[model samples]
Target: MPNNPPIIDVIIPANNEEQSIGHVVREIPGIVRSIVVVNNNSTDTTAEVARQAGAEVVDEPIKGYGRACLRGIAYLLNKETPPGILVFLDGDYSDYPGELEKVVAPIIHQNVDLVIGSRELGIKEPGAMTFPQVFGNWLSTRLMFVFYGVKYSDLGPFRAIKWEKLQILNMVDQNFGWTIEMQIKAAKHGLQYREIPVNYKKRIGTSKVSGTVKGTFMAGYKIILTIFKYL
Candidate 1:
């Protein structure tokens, strides 16, 4: 491990998560150098709440998860001194923000390039993940193993990566394929990666991607399509 702690910055992509964005921001560990919440075309006061809770909020008028994440990355890249590590977290309270240290531990101590928080190996509250969400993760990961020869337990959004390694991925997906796109590119680029368990709970609001039939189908379709696109 380095004598000094690596500079860590967090990025949270939020839609209409006004009810949980504040909590997510406030609960993040103090080790983080900055917390950026991307307001992804939300009608609610997500930006206001996140700012009130000490997060720097950026607006992404386009309604895409990857778009919001890209906006956050752009904000960090403009900084005079960029962080050493970048953590991608959900604005929903479903994830335990306090466990951020655990998620980033591999990168800090083990010199791993990327770390994914695997909810599959973690303790989850009942009904935390819907059936479609579970099935989609299973199928998508299985397909990735077959096609890309990479084994991933869960494509959980709570993840961390070295800033330099993240820049090498050249992420371009503007929608549901954001997380998988990163993972796939990481595998292709030969980045050292690991997965650690992270507890999960019921989210404060309905998931925009998994709460409706249309949303679930679209997400599943996009994820599968993305896995094949890289092949």
Candidate 2:
């Protein structure tokens, strides 16, 4: 294996994403060594679509945001040699998979440990992000600055990390706080991290977390508590 061409792995946690999952999978850079799609108990044909798109599909029967991610990460962990870079993106197609190179390049070519895709810096289509979600991201990111001393914008699902270093995070969130949990742990471990702009657009379907009031509240509470828990 050439040292410059790191083995790249992409994990997509999908739930009923038949409409756009296929496109998302296809758009992922071919330079990626492997693509893992965690089908989280979708009633639709997400698994079939992803498989048809040449992505390895795994089942996460339990329905939790983090549940699917944990399952996917476990699959990666079991691999003989861990990938040099791990990229996590939503299967809903809201994030531009083509921009993945920009997100992972910092960690792959440089010495960064984590790279966050910041929607705040990128273009967000109209109605792509709900008002509450925008506010929530702003508020939560501000809290992180005040409490954790780390500055960040949107906790957009599109992100990347060093595979070996990520395992030490020991993330335990089985719900919406998975991103924040990883962020908190990264801060605690003092990992080198950076954020870059990534384009965003409206998803083909409604968001499971932000589409419903109850789900949004639960997500906000979980994210806040996750940060507080570490602090």
For 100-182, candidate 1 gives per-residue lDDT tens digits of 99999999889999999999999999999999989989998999899888899999999999999999999999999999999
Candidate 1, which ten residues in sequence have the lowest lDDT sum? 1-10
Q: lDDT by residue for model 2 over 1-231, one digit each (tens)? A: 246688899999999999999999999988898899999999999999999999999999999989999999999888898898899999999999999988988886677999999999999999899888999899989999898889899788899998888888987889999998888789889999899999899999889998999989999999988878988
What TM-score does model 2 achieve against the real structure? 0.97
Candidate 2 structure lDDT: 0.91
Give the least accurate 10-residue stretch of model 2, judged by summed lDDT.
Answer: 1-10
Alpha-carbon shift of residue 124 in model 2 (angstroms): 0.8
Each prediction's TM-score versus the true structure: 0.99, 0.97
